[model samples]
Target: MLCVVYKSPNKEGAYLYLERRDDFRQVPTALLDTFGKPQLITVLNLAKREHLAQIDIHKLQAALKTQGFYLQLPPPPENLLAQHKASLQNDKG
Candidate 1:
């Protein structure tokens, strides 16, 4: 299926995918407010690809079919303090 991709300037690396271009009927108003103005990124054909850079192709397609839209948030920031605590525990062990 062909899907439209949009990126929000408010949050870096965050993307919103829609089943059709400029279609946001399925997307919630609160989400749209937080997502900010969506800048068109690209239109992708899922059937023509095996994988996506950061998303699972199967899950994306499923979401598009069921929910009509998919939100792609950036990975959480690394927690240095949590890592340090884990390392200290390992050292004690």
Candidate 2:
């Protein structure tokens, strides 16, 4: 089992992606503190595979909170200017 952490492109929040033996799961980033950079902690519960299988947003939040983390949803990705231009040209044509 492996847990990966990533910061959002907008720098607003982060995300955690978990890889297990047979599946993958995503959890919202956690805001731990007010000072310094917010650290996102991802714990791979090797023994709780069964529980994780039925994990919901609230349960995920609670699990993170137990480790002194807070849930934070990251901002959506911004559209690139070039991509936008191309999309507009395609629509016009």
Candidate 3:
């Protein structure tokens, strides 16, 4: 399967994948509004790829098949303070 990827202009590290290039018929208007204007990224052949850097290939494919689109959100920021506290507790035990 082939997909077109678009980066969100308002969001960093957010991407939208569609089964067809520039086709947003299947996507909801509210989602599109929040996603902001999409900037062209690339066209990808899912069949040729075994893995994706941020998204799971299988899950992406499934979403495309069922929903005609997939939204990739950036991972949550790591909390260093929480990690440090956990480490201190561990050291005391």
Candidate 4:
């Protein structure tokens, strides 16, 4: 399926994917408020076989089918060393 994506003005790397271009009616008003204004990004074909940098294509398709929109939040920043130490402590505890 072809999906249209919009970038949020308020958040970096945050994107909203919709089933169609120029349609935000299915998006909740409260979410739109928090998302700020959306800037058009691109339209692409989404499929389980496709690869996306931050989002899973199958999950995006499921979300779009059920919710009419799919939200792609930025990937969480990693702290590998800190996480390793925390894991060691947990193992000891």
Best candidate per TM-score, number? Answer: 3
Clashing residue pairs in candidate 1 are: none
Report the poorest 10 consecutive residues by lDDT, candidate 4. 45-54
Write down the lDDT of every candidate, Cα atoms only: 0.96, 0.44, 0.96, 0.90
Question: Which candidate has the highest lDDT of all?
Answer: 1
Poorly placed runs, candidate 2 (over 4 Å): 1-62, 65-68, 71-73, 80-83
Q: Compared with the true structure, what per-residue lDDT tens digits does model 4 show for residues 1-93? A: 899999999989889999999899999999999999999998887753477887777888889999999988888889999999999999999
Q: Supply every candidate's count of residue pairs whose N, Cα or C atoms clash at under 3 angstroms.
A: 0, 0, 0, 0
- Tell me the tens digit of each residue's lDDT in model 1 across 9-77: 899999999988999999999999999999999999888999999999999999999999999999999
Q: TM-score each candidate.
A: 0.94, 0.26, 0.95, 0.79
Tens digits of lDDT, candidate 3, 1-93: 999999999889999999999999999999899999899999999999999998999999999999999999999999999999999999999
Score residue 7 of candidate 3 by CA lDDT.
Answer: 94
Residue pairs in collision within model 4: none
- The alpha-carbon lDDT assigned to residue 2 of candidate 4 equals 91
lDDT of 4 at 3: 93
Q: Can you write out model 2's per-residue Cα lDDT over 27-93, one digit (the tens) per residue?
A: 3223223222424445565444544443364555455445423234555677799789999999999
Model 2 TM-score? 0.26
The segments of candidate 3 whose C-alpha lies over 4 angstroms from its true place after superposition are none
